[model samples]
Target chain A: MTTIQNRQILLAKRPAGMPTEENFSFVETAVPKLQAGQLLVNTLYLSVDPYMRGRMNDRKTYVPPYALNEMITGGVVGQVEESLAEGFVPGDIVLGNFGWALYNVAAAASVKKVNPDLAPISTALGVLGMPGLTAYYGLLDIGQPKEGETVVVSGAAGAVGMLVGQIAKIKGARAVGIAGSDEKINYLVEELGFDAAVNYKKGDLRQQLKEACPSGVDIYFDNVGGTVSDAVLSLINKGTRIPLCGRISLYNLEQADIGPRIQTQLLINSALMQGFIVSNYAEQAEEGLNQMAQWLKEGKINYTETITEGFDNIPKAFLGLFCGENTGKQLIKIADPAR
Target chain B: MTTIQNRQILLAKRPAGMPTEENFSFVETAVPKLQAGQLLVNTLYLSVDPYMRGRMNDRKTYVPPYALNEMITGGVVGQVEESLAEGFVPGDIVLGNFGWALYNVAAAASVKKVNPDLAPISTALGVLGMPGLTAYYGLLDIGQPKEGETVVVSGAAGAVGMLVGQIAKIKGARAVGIAGSDEKINYLVEELGFDAAVNYKKGDLRQQLKEACPSGVDIYFDNVGGTVSDAVLSLINKGTRIPLCGRISLYNLEQADIGPRIQTQLLINSALMQGFIVSNYAEQAEEGLNQMAQWLKEGKINYTETITEGFDNIPKAFLGLFCGENTGKQLIKIADPAR
Candidate 1:
């Protein structure tokens, strides 16, 4: 057998604040021969999510921190190159938590087959995969958007936020989006059918948000927590529900920023704010995925992705998340599957 | 009917910081003649609670803000001196939302009879009243404490906090109390049967809290929000529940204080923090009060009070709440049951 060489990216240093390309290093190594019950997979698509930033810090979050000088692990859609397991065959598309590399050696149990007939294979890492399920349970289970109620989502053009807005609309609620750029705002309102969208960088956020949500915010899907969230929180109605998902805006800060306390706001309004990760509802993953896929098939929802070509750009794609450079799901398109 | 002069307390001014005696003004008014379905009640005990602090700031809360120059209203246990309604009663102990006055004229339907045979009539304003229900529903409903979990209550010596700790214990959870004084801490551990207690005034709150809750906090009944709540928040375990019942520590501030943001902490742990007034569970008030009464009857919970004598001292007792002067339920003992 000719040894296949793998190009892997590793965490060179733990970031103090904003991460730079210097924090990552690339190395070339020969892919290991698969043991029985193991499969050799070729990376086709890799997901770069805001949550990966939390893994970079030495502190533990819901998931354990990524160790320094180790291969970074994330969601990757791959094609089985060779398999020793009974269920998987060569040329089968699979999804697994694999390294930022050209190839992965995984136990057959760790990877699941992706049915291409449902959607594009890349959607397995984004719209039909983890991000989709995240938006599903977080918004429906926690947010509980009611008919005619207002649901304001921050990071509205991001993968989860875009789905959150459309799902709110499907529930007969008024969907409002808060994004950093007017271009993303346009995509949220015009493309995703959000009732209103605000550009946090443009004018007065409080006034713009007030004009957007005339009836007051009933459910706030918090993704980017900072001054933009501060503006949305001030407009919460009585019985408001805030699903605390991700705080990407605060992920890279060296010093924790002090802000206005929201406890009193929640108190006076008799509101509820609950934080959750998708794995909290891991038992219902299949059900959630089916529902999200149905919405896609019925044209009740739309998905957008910003794909960067080649494996070397994964770190740059991830860093761009902090500056709101990606449209929706950011992905690194590795080589296409070999026949 | 001869005119009966009533000594009523009104909101003289909205306090910018800590409320003083100057914020309350005494006015003399005549008690009107009783019409059909009316009762003339003599105030026996007036309950002073931390929640009233939010109502005094001229901002709308769960209850509307106290209007300036109007009478200050709160929980009052009274003796019906005369009644023209069907429940024909003289010397019947009753509970009503009444003004801070020596006497109140109320519609018969507005006040509920307090049975003296069950407990002291004052218990209708304390342990079996709004404060007790606040503690019960907030801790049991929102906190949802599981057996063997560690539950921490801030402002642990106050009316609601004291009851929250005891209810947590009733649910078979380990109860930890956070108070300001050594005397209060000793009371919590000795008299209230708290598994552990921390004095915020003592050296190293974080160290003391860590030692007290070695397993980390599973539930935090936040009665006083500020630096103490922040300290408790930092040590939360996964799936921790925080019921934001009040924020007495932050109420008197001239300006909103900037503090460490808690959303990230909540997100990382997949925790929940809900704000609620007791009225949020108004439909279940009777059931909550019945359960609380049963617990009291079984000696599973205890009650305490710090009674200030005379109607003239109501304002002083209210002001003392912010300074942590009361050991338990604070009330004014106003001319006991008019014979």
Candidate 2:
């Protein structure tokens, strides 16, 4: 018989501005025994995405908001430590929505075991996972990039943006990436084969973008919506498609305030701007992942992750995304090398 | 041979706010005989739509703005008094982009001869024409309303809104029309088969919309985009489709003004709001007109035209739309029957 245990990181309080070390309390207890049709998993890596910011608000959303004093939940890659399910056993690595904890006992249907021979296990949280699918579908399906068209992607050095720029190249569209730093810009253009990369922190973004895309923008994959999106809207051609993935700039602000007004321009140009959440498109995830995994295997796609060393550092890694501190996908390595 | 009369209305001045008699001037000239492949049409009914207000501005648009001291051009229904073209003959009713005038020579290709035996000639300027086709394609193709869902349409008793509400009903969806006057509301419900109609001038808008559409809005056909559209956005369901046909409320306002802020709610509900002009979909105009014609013959669709007495009153009718004075499709009857 397996012993029961509780290992978790509970939210100490709703973060006021930026989350600190005091916000997370990591605790350990007996390992929980699995029930019928359930499996016990030992956490390998936990994903940290910017969308998790909305969940902490305790407001109404497409999904339920995370409760105070509860464990923060997100996508996880873990090894099946024990199994009470029919098809799984010890040593099978699975990918699912396990949270910020050491061990998880979940219903069998909630997790999918990974094929490590096909791709690396960490890819289940990065290039072969939700972020990868988001880039693939949001660009191809919603952005609808045509050959020789100019594409502008905001958050160009992040997990989704890097892949989007590369995919635009594959589709014969010119990819222009917008990021926050010189290193990220160099990586996006020199390494990822982006046609151009603009550091938005620099002055005169509109002038820079005008110089980069003389023909004007056609497909814009908007990950960071604020002044960057506002500037890009002016450069967009008639019938341009803007796939709105995230609005990282507006996430922290709590009041009904206006920043950039785009509706007047949106109307004049007849551009199509659409907002999409990755999880809502789960039905197409398998198709997206299969294509992304193939690209990963063939060395056609690349990804980078800023790995935080402990379960206690999950909040730090998440908050780092807003400050432009993380280079690509951000993940937390929760487990120490031990049984 | 019919006399070629050069009759036109010129833009006298750019208006500061609402256009007045001082903004327009009428002139009549000696008739010049028609050239080969040209048809001379005696203008019967002249269309004065809200979009004509857009053409008055010096700014560039999908179509160029009306130049000062030039004839203001729009859709018209006329009787062909003379024809040098093979297809068009004398005594035939025709429709074309005939300017605000009494008699004009039109190119054979640009004018379509209307068969009065099939439908009323006035319909060629109203329900079976641009406004009908606009409402048909924008609602069904863009909005894509489903059965039992609530649809909210602004400018509820006007040409496009009247047709959109009827089209919504035909699709098995509940149509909630928003207009300014109680008379328009009564007409919308009693004549057009709207499920509900809201008089924005009378009561609390948001509360009334909530009461009318307790289930939340599914499709929003926005012809007037100021306060009414802002109110509708608050009551939209997740995945709601908005076909933004016009923003008549903001047409005259020059400055960046404040109204309702809706972007956060737009992200929260995962709704889509897209702007469109009818001329972009002109390729399908024949198909839309054919379907609309059949519906018109079956008594399934109805429209009203507020007929002004003369061509000189065109500015008054156009300005009345902004003041919420016109009851239905505003038309200027230029020809005197008694003469």
Candidate 3:
């Protein structure tokens, strides 16, 4: 048997604030042989997301914190290089939480086969995957955007935010996007058909948001919580629904972020605010994926990926998420499958 | 018709922060004649609540702000002195939104008859009225306290809070009360049958609340929002429900109240928080009142009123609400019905 070397990235230390390159360590090790009911996967695409930052801390979150020096795990699209499992065959494209590694020996039950012909193999890690499912349930179930209602999305150019705004529009609601840059704002409004887009980095956010939402905000899909959220919350109308999907803006703070208390605003409008993770709807993920895939096929939905080439650039891609360096999904390409 | 002298308390000026005696002005005028379909009612019990503080400001809320120099209106129990209406007659006791006055001539449609035979007439201003209904819908519909769940109520000795804690117990949930004083704490535990009670004004509130709730809080009925709520929020469990009924602490603040942003906490726990007024559940009020009356009959629910005697004392009574001088409902007694 030929020996294969695997390159992996590990969390060197828990971050005190914004993570730097020093927080990650790289290693090379021999890929382990797959036992019975196990499959060897060669990583193709690795997803980098904002929620991964929470897992780096020592504190408990929805997912357990990563131990120091351990390989970090996240959504990965790969090809089965070898299979000792009954259901999987070599050359099958698959997706699993095999993480920041070039190769992984995972149990068959942990990985699901992805059809490359369906859309694209990488879509399994972005739109047809966790980020798409996140936007689906959070917007339709929690935000409940009604027809003719105004729906405002923060971090509107990011993976989940972009999909959320588009989904709101498909539901017959007016979609307003709030992005950090003018270019992202233009892309969201002009290319994605967002009803309006505001650059949070420019002008008065409150005034810009107010001008964007003439009927007052009925649904707020929040991915960036901070002053941006505070501004949107101030404009919420009666029965407003806020699906709190992420707080990327405050994720790097070393101390607690302070702002005006939102209880009074919520009470005055009889509003609803809920926080959720995509896994919360795991039971309904299939249905959500079907609808999302149909939307993609019909040209009602579209997605873009900011791909960083090479295995060693995974950490760089992950850190770039904090700086809003990605327009949609952020991924690192490891290697193409052997034909 | 003989002319009668009426004494009214008008909102002299909107309060800058906490209200004072000067914010109210007493005026004397002729009691308007009862026209067709109108009933001339003499005020019996005038309710004072934390929600009224919002109305005293020139800012909009779920209810409109009180206009300066206009008579302030709220829930009031009165006796019909004369009636030209079909359903109401002289000597009928009723409840209406005619407030801060010794007398009023209101349309028959505005006031509903209170059955003095079912409960004390004052209960129409407390247990069988708006406060009780507020606790019912906010706790049952929003809080959704299931059996064996831990339910925490801030301002647990106040009008709506007392009922909220009691309702949690009736549903077989553990009730934890947070009050400002030892007396109120004792009333919650010993008299009202709350499972555990903590005095927020005492040493180490977070530690005390942690001790009182062996299980993490699952439902929080928040009447007081400040440090007390911040402590409770820190201990909330997965799927926790918070019904934001009032924010008495922030109501008097002249500036924005700053606190740790709660979106991350809500996301980490996958929780839901909703704010509601009792009027949102108006259609279900009859079912709520009937159940409350049954509970009272079965000794499952009990209420107390901190009553102030005389029409001249209404301003003092309204001021006392901010100081937490009331145990349960606070009402000003204008006059007893003349036999």
Off by over 4 Å in 3: none
Clashing pairs in 2: A4-A30, A4-A31, A5-A30, A5-A31, A5-A32, B4-B31, B4-B32
lDDT of 2 at B311: 69
DockQ of 3: 0.89
User: Alpha carbon lDDT of residue B225, candidate 1?
Assistant: 90
Write model 1 residue lDDT over A43-149, tens digit each, in one string. 99999989999889897899999989889999999999999999999999999999999999999998999998899999998889999999999999999989999
Looking at model 1, the pairs that clash are none
Clashes of each: 0, 7, 0
Q: Stretches of candidate 1 above 4 Å error?
A: none
- Whichever of 2 and 3 has more lDDT, that candidate is 3
Per-residue CA lDDT of model 3 for A1-339, tens digit only, reads 899998899999999999999999999999987799999999999999999999999999888999899999999999998999998899999999985898998999999989888898889988899999999999999998889999999999999999999999999999999999999999999889999999999989999999999999999999999999999999999999999999999889988888988998999999999999999999999999999999999999988889999987888889999999999999888888676
**C-alpha RMSD by candidate, in order:** 1.0, 2.2, 0.9
What's the residue-level lDDT of A169 in candidate 2? 88
Ranking by lDDT: 1, 3, 2
* Poorest lDDT segment (10 consecutive residues) of candidate 3 chain B: B330-339
lDDT of 3 at B316: 93
Query: Where in model 2 is the C-alpha error above 4 Å?
Result: A1-6, A16-23, A257-261, A336-339, B1-5, B257-263, B336-339
lDDT tens per residue, model 2, A1-339:
656666797777776555666877777777655689999888988998888877877677656778888888889998887789999988888888976888888888999988888876888888888889889988998888889999999999998999999999889999999999999999999988999999899988999999999999998898887678778887888788888888777677655545444555556677777777787678989989998888877888877888888866777888888899888888888763233
TM-score to true structure, per model:
0.99, 0.95, 0.99
